[model samples]
Target: MILRLALGLFAALALALFVQPQAARAAYPCPGGPGPGEVQVGVSGGSHGVAAVPICDRAQGGGGGGGSEVYYRYGSIAWHPDADDVWMEGSYDGPNTAERTALAACNQAMGGGCTSIGEWHNSSMRIFRDRSGALWSGWHGDGGVHSKKTLADCSAKQLLPCEVLGTYSSSKNRHLPKPTARKLYAVGAWVEGTEGFDSRLYIASGQRDAATAERLALDACTKATRQRCAILAFVGNGVIQTYRLGTGDQSATVESNAKRAAQAAQANCKKRGQACTLQRVYDSRTPGEFVHDFMAPAAK
Candidate 1:
């Protein structure tokens, strides 16, 4: 009996070896359960097959063989854990569909309350929601079109970075917000004692002295004039000149004596006036800028 059984097993094994074997499994199907673009048609089998299932591309290990992650592909984009689903959907393949999906996600996430969607942006979607829970779509684009004042959405609310970068300023203006600083020459001139004249005008980096202002003041007025004074204060775009009108057509004499008279006047002012009182010269130009005192109480 034992010999017969052994012979029978050998015959079966020989028969199996003669038949053609099945091909090995290839790459796992497009994640979610071997669908269209899948390598092997039906579900995987045995040790060579996929074991543990995935949760929306996330794997849950099981059995002796570790389970493989199942990724969901929307067009060319693939999403995984820790990735922004809304952004992925919005940025994938086509703009119309992806952007629409992204908008829906954002609107749903934010409570659907404010203004409607304004415009679609590269990485951002603008949905306007008011306190009343109304939702308006396509209001702001990615760079943020609408200027939102407060933070809140109606039905479904989504919180975004609080960076105002839209066409409105404080939700009141329609034009784009003004820039904080503009690249401009800001060309401005003031005679001696004028605008920035606390005697702290800097000629260049690391070079500053009160005498610079005094010198400028002395040469501000026209030559050959009775004026023999320095500019005490000049602001905006204007000039100042002082007069020491001597007796008669000192016009000719004044021009000739300008250098000497100016020197004398400056020296006299420094000696007679504490802090060197520089005289004020009259000006005719209108002011364009003004001095703003922002010093603290102690300094004031």
Candidate 2:
């Protein structure tokens, strides 16, 4: 009898050893059919490193294998070898509302798998790739990058007027898109000085040629100052040309333009009158490419 019992125990141990390791399970996803405000069970926040709970071992101890339950308002999932590093991600259905009906439903169907849920705010701005291979810029909130927000509705297909906003005293340090970008821009002058020409001197879209840039510059200056304006570009070897407009005398304008143009033509040139402050400036070595009073200096 003793020998038979020993053999049976040994066989049981072998069977236990031979059993396959239980595969790590994934979080239950929300059903696809839903409207804009669809709630779902997803990877919760604060789950960068948590062990996966084995389905076979759910009843013994509290689930999650001593790992803390993590919640996310939106779903963003990832997997890795280390149990502590495994994470699940998803959109939090509740942003304005506090309840998590969707998350509860998901857990109910999955035999009590649970992730704490919390709504997330605008996380970050990123470039999203759509199926068409085009890149769209939008804000990342708790509901993922394409979720809704109080200020802006990014859920729509296109992100229109992707301008930066809210850098002034009236607003916080947020960067909203235009028509918001336009609102945040200082009313006095978008560009440095030449305030009167501010409205006319808008930054043109796309890269501009020498002639085109010069023409636009003149347009802005004349619109702001109402004086005859000339814009010139450096062509190296001391050759430069100017684009001009308005009734102001060409002589003085060209003289000023030439003087300003020459400053740029010289090595390590900055402002029209500002000195080449550094001795070993990189432009001193490279030929061609000179700095003109083109784009306004960044605001302090």
Candidate 3:
């Protein structure tokens, strides 16, 4: 009986060792045997779980394993005197390639006086001509460049009456067919009640042109308030500001059109024996209103 019992104990120990390893190994196996386009299973550490990896055939380019490919191309355009003779080239491997292609095409068609207007890579750009007839271009990377920023850039370069001519986008695969230009204007007003109140100010902007915008602002202030309104500033597509400095009926000046506006205002204020400071700066292309009291601080 003792011998039989010992033999039984040995058989149970062997079973435990053999069966445990087999069960663990079976938990994670290659879902499909080693082959192209097969699922590979791996055991995670410490009871975390099993993970499945995909096997790909690089030779056949069958599977990418969630990877993607990207290609970059450039676009360029050349402009001549005649609109119909404009030449454009796109989908080139390099910027110079697009530029050369456009120039070559343009020169081939219309002698040798061809100028490259713009170039872009995997993106878009817009061209504009200011009232001064200067060409400016704005580039957009993903969505597009902001119209305000583009206009501001042109204005900063002292290009007046700036307007967008057209847009070219690689993604769109074409240029804007029509001239989609918009005009921007800014205006400011100052008013004072003849009865008792001090000066009241208003600014209006984003009109089709400078004269209309100024007229609209002055009209609005005159009709809405009981005070007499006077035009302080009128400008087109640029920054404008007013300054009121020192105490007791401060002198005010409008800053716009020229950099000399500020210097003149400051000089005038200083002539009155008071320290003049900037009160407000305004953009005509941006529609808004501002109001402040110069007398309040003096009264205090």
lDDT of 2 by residue, 100-121 (tens): 4434533443334444323222
Which should have the higher lDDT, number 2 or number 3? 3
lDDT of each: 0.22, 0.23, 0.45
Question: Which stretches of model 2 miss by more than 4 angstroms?
Answer: 1-70, 73-94, 97-123, 127-300
Model 1 compared with the native: what TM-score?
A: 0.16
lDDT, residue 228, candidate 2: 58
Distance from true position, residue 145, model 2, in Å? 9.6
Question: Model 1: which ten-residue window has the lowest total lDDT?
Answer: 5-14
- What RMSD does each model have against the real structure? 33.2, 26.1, 29.1
Assess the local accuracy of residue 193 in candidate 2 as a C-alpha lDDT between 0 and 100.
34
- What digit string (tens of lDDT, one per residue) describes model 3 on residues 89-190? 776654367667777876765566667644545555555543222344444332332333445545443313345666665433333222212335666665
lDDT of 1 by residue, 205-278 (tens): 01022234334334333221224433322221112222222211000000012243244334433343423222
Cα error, residue 222 of model 2, in Å, equals 4.4
